[model samples]
Target: MNNKTKSILYGTLASSILLGVYFTVLTLVSGWSFTQ
Candidate 1:
């Protein structure tokens, strides 16, 4: 594999992971607010 391809793959993976964590935190916060 080339350097460019590897970097693209890594960037996509990191962004997806960050987005997942962001949404999870958002959902939990909303849920807690609803309970209170």
Candidate 2:
């Protein structure tokens, strides 16, 4: 892949991981339960 495409892919992947981590931490702190 070219530099531009590679960077975009890496950036998207990083953001996704960060967002997932953020939500996980938020739910953990709030004692969130998905079934509820």
Q: Who wins the TM-score comparison?
A: 2
lDDT of 1: 0.88
What RMSD does model 1 have?
4.1
Model 1: residues >4 Å from true position, as ranges?
A: 32-36
List runs of model 2 lying over 4 Å from the truth.
Answer: 33-36
Clashing pairs in 2: none
Error of 1 at 35 (Å): 15
Against the reference, the lDDT scores of all candidates come to: 0.88, 0.87
Candidate 1 collision pairs: none
Candidates in order, TM-scores: namely 0.81, 0.84
Give the Å error, residue 33, model 2: 6.3
Cα displacement (angstroms), candidate 1, residue 7, comes to 0.3
Q: Tens digit of lDDT per residue, candidate 1, span 1-36?
A: 999999999999999999999878877888766544
